[model samples]
Target chain A: MLRALRNHHGEPSVRRPLFSPVNLAKAIGALTVAILAGVLLSGGTFAYMNSTVALPSATIKAGSAALTTTGTPLVLTGLYPGQTQSAAFTINNTGIVPLVLNVSGVAAPAADANSLSAALTIRVDVTTAAAGCSILPGTAGWQGTFAATLPTANAPVSLNSTLAAGATATLCLSASLPPSAPSTVQGGTTKSFSVTIGGVQS
Target chain B: MTRSRILSSARSRIGVAVGLVAFLVLVGSGTAQATWTTLSSAQPATASATTASVLLSDISALNTTYNYTGTTSPLVIAPATLQNTGGAPLTYTLTETNTNATLAAKIAVWIWLQVSGSCGTTTVGTAGTLAAIPALPAGATSGTAGQSTVVCIATQLTGTILASSGSTLTANFTLTGKVGANWQGTDPSSITQSVFQAADVTNITCSTSGHGSNTTATVSWSLPAGATGASIYVGSTLVLPDTSTVSFTATKANVGSATSITIKANYASGVQSAGVVQALDSANGSGCG
Candidate 1:
C-alpha cells in the first residue's frame, strides 16, 4: 500500500515531454485532492483550508410544537342545541427548533387533504406529542370535522416534528357540515364556526 | 518501432492527466460546501376542545383596570399566567340574544351584568378585579366550572315584552379596547338569550250580579291547566284563597255588584286589584256570591 501511494503521490515520476502542462497539472491536482479529503473527513465545518480545524458537533432538539386555537373548543351554538354545524381545526408550534409533522397519522374524512382520517368520539383528534413534531389539524391535510359531538374535556394538540426555536405552525379549522351520513348531522347545513389556529414551540 | 513507442507514451500521459484533473475539482469543492437537513413529527385530532386556555378579551389600558371577570363566580377567564395571547389592551363585549324568539315577548332584559371578585369588603360588580384564582397555583374558582351559563348572564326586572315587537330581541355586540393598555383585542360576546314558555292565562269573571232565593248561579273561568292556586276578594271586606276551582264557593246572604272586592294570594294581594265590586242580579248569583 505504501509503495502504491508513492507511485501516485504528488507528481508521478513519469518521464515525458518536459513541457506537458496537462500531465504535470494532473499529478499536482491529484495530490492536492487526496490531502484535502483527509482533512475534510476529520469534520471540517468550513472550507477555510488552513483555518481552525476545530471538529465540533451540534444537535438540534426542539421542544414539543404545541398548538392552540381561538374561541371555544366546543360551542353550544347552532339554529338549535341539537342542530348540525361545521367546524375547523388549527395547529401551531411554539418551539425554538423546526419540526416535521406527519399528517398521515391524523385520522379524518377523505377529500381535500392529501390523506384520509376519521373523527374521534368526544374528541377533536388533536392529541399531544413531544417537541419538534406536529400534524395538520384535520385530514385531507388542512380542514375537516369531528363528524360527532365536540366535548370540553379533551385537548387536541398536533405537534410539529421539529419546532424551530420560537417558530410556529398554523392550520385553519372550519366546521364540517357533513354533506352526508348519520341521523344527527342533518346531512348538510349552512351553519358553520369560524376556525382559527394558535400555537408555540417549547 | 518509433510509432508504437510514441503511442504507448501518449496513452500513459493521458491517463495521468484525467486522474489529476478529477482530483483538482474535488479539492476545490471543499472551499464552499454546505448541507441542510429537515426534521418533522406526527399529530392529528382524534376529537375536539383542545385548549381551555383563558384568553384575555378586553384588557383596558386607559381603563387600566387591575383585573376583570365574566361571571358571578369571578373566575378570571383571560390572560392566564404563562398562558396568554400577550396583546395590548383589548375590548370584550358580552351580548345576549333571545334564543326562544317566539316566547320572548314581554320578557325583561338586564344589560351589563359582569362577574366580579372581592377586594376586601368590596361587593363585586364594579370594584374588584379577578384572576383565575387569587390563590397560588392559579386554581380555578367557582365560576370557571360548570356549564351553567346562568351566572355568566345578566337579565333585567320582569318587563312586559310586547308581542307587537316580533317576539324577539337581538343585542348588537361590540367592544372598545382601552388605549395604551396591556391588551389590544376584544372578546366580543355572541350571547343567546333562550326563552322559556309560560302557560297562557285568562281573566276569571262572575257572570251574575245577584241571586234570588234558591237560585243556581254558574261561575266559570279560563286558564292554562297548571293553575297551582288562586284567590278571590269580597269587596274590601275580606279575601279568600282557593286551591281548586271545583271546590271554590262564596255563599254570602247579601251580594250585589256594588259590593266591593279584593283578591289575596299567600295572604298578600297578588298582582290583581283590590276594592273591586261585583254586581248583584236576580237572574244569576252575584260575582262569587
Candidate 2:
C-alpha cells in the first residue's frame, strides 16, 4: 500500500494539447535562426584598416635667426631703411600635407610702430626645393635689394609668422636698416617693433 | 495514456528548442553590414583666403591609411564631407593687400572652420593669418602625422580684423560664390578681412544696406583713421578697383543706381579701406576678372 501511494504521488494525470504541423515547422525555423544569429554577431565585429591624407596648417614663430630661410628677413639694426633681403630655405612636406604661406609684416622704426595690417600682403608661392630646401615664390630672382629704415633708433624689433597646410619655403631675407643717421648715433639705437618674419608647416 | 504522455513531452522539448533558436536569429542580424553612405558632395564647405584649399577635407575622407576620431559620433551624428567638386585642387592663392599705404601696417587673413551641413547658412567661426611659412629652420625637424580626422569641416574662409576685431582701420568683404546662400541665416557667412594692422583709423561700417534704388545711388565710405582713396566697383564696370576711401570718395558717373546693380570694392592687403561696397546683386555677380 505504501509503495502504491508513493507511485501515485510521483505520477500526475494531465491532458496534452494537439500537436500541429505549423508548430513543428516554426520550432525548427527558430532553432536555425538562433544558430545563424550567434555566428553573425561574432562575424560582424571586425577591425578594418583606415587611411588619411594629411595637410599641414600654417604656423609661425615671432623671433627666429634662421639664415637659410627665404623671405623678408627681420631687421635688427645695422642696416639702411626700406632695404629688403632675400634668400632660400628648405620646406619639405615630410608629412602627408601641403603648407601655404602669406607674407606681410611692417618695418617698425624707433619713432613709429609700423602696422602689420598696412603692410602689403603678397602671395609668395613657396616651393619645396631639393630635399631639405624650399624657395619663396616671386623672390626666385629678385635682384633689386631693399633696406629697412628706422625713423628714430633703438626701437623694439621682431618678426611674425604665417603658414598654411603643408606649403613651405626656405630663403634668406634681404633686410635694410635706416640710412647712416645724422645724430651721432649713426650706429642705430636698435629700435624694434613687432614684425612677422616667416611662416612654417604646422 | 503512456503514448500520449510521450508525444506531449517530445513536443514540449521541440518548442523550447525552437524558442531559443528564434532568439538567436534575431540577435544575429546586427549593424555591421549596414554601413553608412558618404554624401556625393559636402555642403557648407567654405573657401577662405586662409586655409581655403587645405586638404583638410580630402584628408578627412582618406580611410585607407588613416583613422578618424571625428568631432561627432557616427551613432548620434552624421557628418557631411566637403568634396572639392571644383575638380581643381584646393587653390588658396588669393592675396590680401592695402595697395596704397602711407605708413607701415599689418595684414592678416582670418579663416573660419565648420563641422558640417548642406553648405547652408554657416558662419565663419575662427580666425587664422595667411602668413608666409618658411622651411624647417636649422636644427629643426618634422614629423608625419595628422593623416586622419573625424571632424568634418564642411567649409573654410578668409577674414580681415575690423572694428569688432578692434582694429583701427577695417575693410568690408563678402563671402561670395559658394556663400551666396545667406548669412545671419543658414546661408554660408563671409570670411572678412576683419583687421588691418594700421593704427590710424577707427570705426568703419558698411552702409549696412547692400545697394540703392535707381538714380544717383549713394555708396557711402567712412574712415576714422582717414583714407585718401577708396575704389568702388560695379562688376568690371569700373576698370580699376577704387583708389581711396579715407578722404576721397569713389563715385560712378553712369547711375543706373539700381539696387540690382552688383558692386564690389576691395583694398589691397595692408590697407584699412577694405570692403567699401553694397551687397551683391545678380547684376553685380561677376567673378574677379
Candidate 3:
C-alpha cells in the first residue's frame, strides 16, 4: 500500500498540449529554412580559378579655367563737384584650374573736352564679401586708384592673389571729383568707363 | 522598445549612413577626370570727356619665314602694331592680359625694334634684337604724330615652331602708355592677336624609280635650323619620319603614277612650320608597259 502511494503521489505529472498539424509544419519549415541558409552561406559548392588578372591603368586629367562676372555694370550719375559714389560687382571662377586675376580700368571720352573722368579721382576697393556689393566676408585683398586717362587704360594690377577653382570675390569701386575741381567739368557727363579683369594660370 | 531592438535599429541606421558616405566618395573621385580648358570674354565700359585720344589701331597678325640660313637663332614675327595718335609723348607698357595659360607657357611675347628697315623677303635687319616686355629698353615711345610701331614678338615653343599643325593661339595684349605730366589723360590701347606660329619651308623634292608593280619613293626637304622633326603626306596618307627625309614603298594602287604630297616640319614647342607641296612619280608597273 505504501509503495502504491509513493508511485502515484511522488511521480511528476506530465501535461502535454494537444499537438496541431499547423504548429508542427511551422516549426519544421523554420528549421529547414535555417539549415538551407547555413549551407548556402558556408557549405555551398563554389570554385575560383587560381590565376591573376591585370586591369588597365587609369589616367588622370586636369580641368579647365573659367571665369564669369555677376551683377550689373557699375554706373554713376548726377555728377557735381566733389561728389563721390560707390558701386560693386562680383567675379567668380567657374573653371577647375586656379588662376591669377589681372584687373585694369579704361576711361572713355566724354562729350566735353574736360569730362568728369579727367576731373574725378577714382578708387577701387576689393574685398572678399559674403555676396556681391555686400559686407566683407574675409580680409580685404586689393585696393588701388584708377589712373587718369581716356582711351589709355590703367596698368594691369594683379589682384595680388589667386582664385581657386570655384571661388568668388567682390570688387567695390568709389569715384569722386575732388573739391579742387577745374571749372571744365561743370555741365558734362563722364563717358562710360570700361574695366577688364583677366585671368591666367598661376 | 527593448534595448536589443533599439540597438538593432541603430546599427541599421549606421549601415545606411556608411553606404551613403561610400556613394559620395565614389562620386567625388569621378570629378578628377575633368579637363582644364581656357575661356576669355570682354565687355565695354565708357569714360567720356576727351582731348586727343590714343587709340589701339590694330593687332595685325604677321608671319616670318623660318630662315634656317639666317643669323637669327629663331624667327620673329611682328603680330601687333600700335600707333600713338594723341598729342602727348607717351611711354608704353604691355600686359599679356588674357591667353591660354598652357599655350602662354610655351611662347614668349617681346618688344622688338625694327632693325632700322623692313623685314621682307631679303631680311634687311643686320641682326634681330629681342626685348622682353614689361620693361621696354628704349621704352616703346610713340612719336608726337600718329607714328605706328610694330610690337614684335619672338615666340618659342617646347619644340620647333612650324606649320599649320600648331594650335591657333589667341593672345590678348593691352598697351597702357600714359604721360606722367599733368592733365595728360592715359589712353589704353588693347588688341588680340591670333598667332598661327607657322614656319616657312622651301626647296622640297620627291622622286621614285623601279619598274615593279610597287615602287620605292624617296622624299627629301630642308627646314629651318630649329626644326625638330618633319612629316610627309602622300595624298591623304601621312608618312611619319624621325629625320628630315623619308622613303616609303608605294603600291601602284595606293599612290597613283604620280601623287602630290605636302611635307611639314615640326619646331620646338609644337610649332608647326608651313607645309611645302611636292610631286612624286611612281615607277611604271608591268601592266603599264
Candidate 4:
C-alpha cells in the first residue's frame, strides 16, 4: 500500500482549470467592453459626417461679344472752298462682351491733278447728340482730322471704351476746306472718302 | 501561497489591464487621423466680339480728254476705284445722275466695273467685257484690307455726243451698299463720285460698191451714229444726207461705159472728207464695183 501510494503521487493528476462559468463570463464581458470602446471611438467621426455630408457637380460656359454700325449717307453737294459740312453715324455693339474702340478716317486725293489735297481738311467727333450733330459736346471724347493722326488707345475719344454689348454710340463727321485754299483748287473733286471704327476686346 | 507572492500576482494583473487600455487609446488615435476629402475644379469664363467694318478708297483722275473718232471709242468716260476694308464682304451699287441738262439729254451714263484679278477694257457682250454695275457678285468686294476694285463711267449718245465736241459734261455717280455677308447692326452708306468729259471726233471712212450689175453705184459711209447736219455729194450733185448708204446712177458716155464718179462729204461743223472716184464698164456699175 505504501509503494502504491508512492507510485500514485509520482503519476501526474489533471486538475480543473480556472475556467469556471462565472470567471468565463467575467472575462468575456471585459473583452466585449474593450472592443466596444474601440469601435465607438472610431464610429464617432463617421456618424457625425454621415448626417451632414453632400456631393454636388457644377458647369460653366463661355460668353461672346460683337460689334456693328449703321447710319445714313454723308454727302456734301457743291462743296466750295472755306465751306463745312456735318453728318452723323451710329455705332452699335451687338456682342456679349464690352469693347474698346479705335476710330480713323481716310480721304482720297483730289481728282484734279493740279488741285491741292492738303488745303482740304476734315474733322470727326464723337458725341451723344441727336441728328445733324449741330452741337458737339464741349468736352468731346474724340476729335481729329482725316489725316493719319487717328485717335488711338492712348488718346482715344472714348465712344465707350467699355462699350457694353448691344449698346449704341453716335458720332459726327465734319468736313471743311480751309479758307486759305488757293484759287487753283476750284472745280476739284474727291471721291471715296471713308471713316472707320474698329473695336478691340477689353 | 505566501502573502508577498499573492501581492506580486495582483500587481501583474493590474498592469495587464492598464496595458490593454493604453493599446486601445493608441488605436483610437490612429483611427481618428483618417479622413475623406471632396475635390473641386473650375474654369475661367470669356467671350469675344464679332467683327464688321467697311471702307471706300479714293478714285484716280479722269483722262484729260476723250475722242469719239479714230482709235478711241465712246465706251469709257472717267475712272474711279472701290475697296472693301471691313471684316465682312460688301455689295456696292453704282448709279449716275447728270447735273447738267445739256449733257444729260445728249448722253446716257453707264457703269463699267473691272472683274477681280483681271482688268476688262471691252464693252458689254464682248470678250474681255466689263461686268455691268449694280450686280451682286459683280460689285462684291472681299472682306480684306487694301482689297481694290476698278470702276469707270461709259457713255451712249442719245442723239449725238459728237455735236458737243470741245464741251464738258458733268455728272455724279453714287455708290451705295452695306455688308452683305452676315450683316447686322451696320447701316448702308452712299458715296458720291464726280465725272467730267471733253469730247472729240475720232474716225471717218467711206466705201463704194456696185448694186446688182446695174449702172448704179452705192456709197456706204462709216461715221459716228450721232453725227448730224452732214451732207454728201457725187460729182457736184447733192446725194446722201448724213446717211449710212446711198445709191446714184453712173453717168454714161458715148461708148456706153460709165464715167468715173467723185464723192465728197461735208459736216456742218466745217469738217470735210473726200473719197476716191470710181469708173465702171458697161456690164458693171461705176468704179465702185
Candidate 5:
C-alpha cells in the first residue's frame, strides 16, 4: 500500500517512519490475533470429548468417643477385719466409637486411728452375667492391697476388653480386710479412699 | 523500567498465591488425621473401718473380806456396775479361778443382774454362776455402748462345812468381753474373798450334736439336782419350753449364724441356773443351718 501511494504521488513521497502510531496499532492487533489463534489450537489438541455425571455429594462425619458409668462413687461403711464388702456398677460406651476402659485408685489420708487403709485390700472383677457381681464369673482383673494396686492416679489398671458403641459392662469392686489384720485396727473408724474409671478410643 | 516493574509484580503475586494454596492443603491434611479421645467423669469410691472396746466402773466394790461362822449360810457382797464403754455392744463371760479347790467345790458363787433392788434380793435375775459348777456358762450382755448393768455377787454354802475354823476361800473373777463375733482380751475384775462352806452344788451340762448343713440339732443336757424342769435357748430365743425331758431336738435357725448354744436348768424353788453354752460345729454353714 505504501508503494501504490508513492506511485500515485508521481515523485517518491516522503517515507513515513516504520513505527508510526497507525503502524504500531496495526502490528499489535496482528500479534494479538496470532497469539489467540495459537492458544485455541493448543487447547483444542489437549482437550478430550467428555461428559460428567454428578455423583451424590460425598458425605463425611467424624465419630465421637465417650463413656459413662452407673452407680458410681461406691461408698462402703462398717468395714471390719476378716470381712469383705462388694459393690456392682456398670460402664456404658456412650459414644459412636468403641472404647477401652481403665481404672485407678486414689486413697485419702488414713482417717482411722489404726490406719486401716494400709491393711485394706481391693479386688476388681468384670462379668457379662446379668446377675451382676453376685455371679463373679470371670477371674479378677486386680487383686491386692489398696496401697499396692492404686498407688497413684497415673497408675491405671486396664479392663482388658474393648467395649463397642452402646455396649455395657458390669464390674464388681470388692474391699476386704484379712483376718491377720493388726489388733490396732480394732475400733478404728473413717478410713477412706476413692476409685476412678476412665475410658479411651480403642 | 516501567515494563520491568510490571513483570516483577506479576511474579511476586504468583508466588504469594502458590504459598497460600500450599498452606491450605497442609491445614486440610492435618485436620483429617487428628485423634479423638474421651474420658469418664470422676467417679469416687470410699470405705471405712470400725473398732471395739469396753470399760468397767465401780470395780472396787468387788474386792471384799467375808468373815464366816459355823451358822453362816450365804453372804451377799457389795454390788458393782459393769459398763459397756466400747463403741459396740458386747456380751461378757465370767470365769472364776479359786485358789482353794476344796472350798470351790463346796461353795457356789452366783452373779446376778440387780434390777432396782439391793444385793441378795430375790427379785434380781441370776446371770450365771462364776465357778466351774456349770460347764460353759454364758454371762450377761452389757448391751450397747455406754450402757450399764448392776451386778450382784452372792456366795452360798452348798453342803455342810467339814472344817469349822481355819478354812478359807479366795476366788478370782475374770470378766471377758466378746466383741462382735470374736472375743477381745480379758478384763480381769477379781472378787477376792474368804468364805465358809456350802451344800452340794447343782450342775447343768449341755452338748450339741448332729448340726451341719441341716437346720435341726440334737441338744442333750444332764439335769441338775433338785431341778424339776429345764429350758433351752439358742440365743435369746427359747427353742424348748420348760420340760423335764433332758434331751430334745431344737431348730438350729434360732442360733442363726451364731455358734453359741445355751441351756438353763429350772428348779422347783423358782430359781433358774445360768446358761451352759456349747459351740456349734463350723460345718453348720450359716443362716438356717
Candidate 6:
C-alpha cells in the first residue's frame, strides 16, 4: 500500500522500507564498534583493580632422613682360623620421621693379597645386652660373606627392625673364619673391608 | 569467511588446547613429586690373620725316674708347661712309644692339665694307651699367644707283673701342636722306672640308684696291702681323683637310659688294679643294688 509522508516543502512523498541493505549494514557496523569498545573498557577496569598483596609468605621445608653411626673404622687384628671376633656399633635416626634401616658390605680392593673378604663369614644382629658380639643377643639380621652380601656398591639388606624418629639401635657384628678355611688365609694375611648402613623414610 | 581467516582460527583453537593440556600435566606432576628419599653412612672394618705355633717348657723335667723297690703305686711325674708362642691359637695331642708290650699292657697312664692345683678333672684319654687321645684344647679358644698350660702326668700298672729285680721299664711320650693344620714342632718326654710284682685290689663292687634324670653309683673296694690311692670314673669323666677313701658315691646327670661306672685301685709301686665296670639304669630310680 502506498503511504504518504510530509516533507519540509509541505509536499506529499513515498516512505522507504526500514530494512534496506545499506541501512542494515550501517547498523551492523555501529554495533560491532560498540561491542569492541565495551571489551576494551572491561579489560582496563579489571587491570586497574587487580592489586596483589603477597599473603604472608608461607615457608615449607622438606623433611630429612638423616642417619649417624659410631664405632666405625674398626680394625680386627690377630684373626685366626676357627676364631671369631666381634664388635658393636650404633645407628641413630636423627631426623623427624621414622626410618627403615639396611646394611651392606663394601669389598676390599682386588690388589689385597689373600683377601679375607670372601673367606670371612659376617653376622649382624640387634642387641640390647652388654656382651661381646660372640654371644650376640638377638637373631642375626644379615649373615654372609662381604663379597656375597654386597656384590656391588650401594646394594643393601634390610635390618630386622625399624627405627623410630630420634631412636638409636645397637648392632653387633661378628666376623669368623671357619675351621675349613684354606691355608692361604694363614701366614698373617690381611684384608680391609667396609660396611654401609643406610636408612629410608618410612 | 576467507580461507586464510578460517585457517588462522583453527590454529588459535589448537594453541589453546595445547596450553590447557600442558597446565594439567604440570598439576598432575606436582602431586607425584612428594616422594621419600634415602640417605646412607659407611663404616670401615679390617681383619688380619696369623700362623699358629706352640712352645714347650720344662721338657727336661718331664722325664720321670722311679725305683719300684721302695716306691709305691701311681708314680707321679714332674709337671710340664706348654705355652702358645705364636700369633694364633693351638691344640695338642699325645703319642706314646713303649719298649715292652707286656709292660705296656699292664701299665696305665693319665695326663691332665693343672696350672697350680690338683690334676684336671678331664683326662687326655682312657687308661693304658694314648693312641685314642683327642685334640685337647690347651685353653679356651684354644691356646692364644702367650697363654700357658701346665700338664700333669701319672703312671700306674694294671696288674701284678713279676720282673727280675733292678729291671727297668721305659716309655717315650710325644706331644704335638695343631691348629687347622698340624704344626711343625712337638714336645718329647720319657718315663723310666723299675719293674716289680704288685698285687691288685680285690672284692671291688659297684651299686647304683637313680633319682630323677640322675644316677648315683656307689663303689666299694678292698685295697691291696700296699695300696696308696684309688680313682673312680663315671663314663669317661673322672668323678674322683686319687684318694684313700674305700667307699665313694658318684652321681651323673641326664643319664637318659643307662651309664657305666668304673673304679680302679692304686698301689705304692706305680700299679693300679684292673678297672671294675658296672652299668646303672635310669629305670631303677627307687632301688639300690
Q: Return the lDDT, model 5, position B248.
A: 50
Clashes of each: 101, 150, 45, 17, 9, 9
For model 6, give the RMSD to the true fold. 21.9
Worst 10 residues of 2 chain B by lDDT: B39-48
Clashing residue pairs in candidate 6 are: B72-B268, B72-B269, B72-B270, B73-B267, B73-B268, B73-B269, B73-B270, B74-B270, B157-B271
Kindly indicate the candidate among 1 and 4 with the higher DockQ. 1
Please give, for every candidate in the order listed, the TM-score of chain B alone compared with the true chain B: 0.35, 0.21, 0.37, 0.36, 0.44, 0.41
- B1-289 per-residue lDDT for model 2 (tens digits): 4657767876887877777676656665645642111111101110111111112222212111111122211111112222222211121212222221211033322232223423233323343222321221221121111121222222211233332223222222211111111101011211222223333323433322223322133344354433444444454465345454432222334423323222223334334432434433224321111
Measured against the native two-chain assembly using Cα atoms, what DockQ does each of the candidate structures obtain, in the order listed?
0.02, 0.02, 0.07, 0.02, 0.18, 0.23
10 residues in a row with least lDDT, candidate 1 chain B: B129-138
Query: Interface RMSD of the predictions, in order shown?
Result: 14.3, 20.9, 15.0, 22.9, 11.5, 10.5
| Superior by TM-score: candidate 3 or candidate 4 | 3
Q: Write the per-residue lDDT of candidate 3 for residues A1-202, one digit (tens) a residue.
A: 3232233668755432332345445555555555555545664476675777898998888567777876356665434444455567767889877877766444444444555666665554556565444443243333333443322223555656677779976766555555455545544566655555656677
Find the 10 residues in a row with the least total lDDT in model 5 chain B. B195-204
| Consecutive 10-residue window with the lowest summed lDDT within model 5 chain A | A15-24
Q: TM per model? A: 0.26, 0.16, 0.28, 0.27, 0.45, 0.49
Shift in Å, residue B251, candidate 1: 4.1
Scored by TM-score, the top model is 6
- Residues A1-202 of candidate 2 have per-residue lDDT tens digits of 3232224667654543455556667668766866785676667466587778888987874432121232232333222222222333433223332222223333433331222112212122333345222234444312111133421112312122323334344433333222221222222233333223222332
Off by over 4 Å in 5: A1-59, A70-72, A104-112, A127-138, A149-155, A160-162, A167-170, A190-192, A200-202, B1-38, B53-94, B97-102, B108-159, B162-172, B177-289
lDDT of 5 by residue, A17-131 (tens): 4344465456555655555565556453554788899899987986788777774578655565566777887778888877777775545545566677777777776666477
Docking quality class, candidate 1: incorrect
Residues A46-129, model 1: lDDT tens digits: 656675566679787743544333334433222111112233333444443444432322233333221111321122333333
Off by over 4 Å in 2: A1-78, A81-96, A104-168, A177-185, A193-202, B1-289
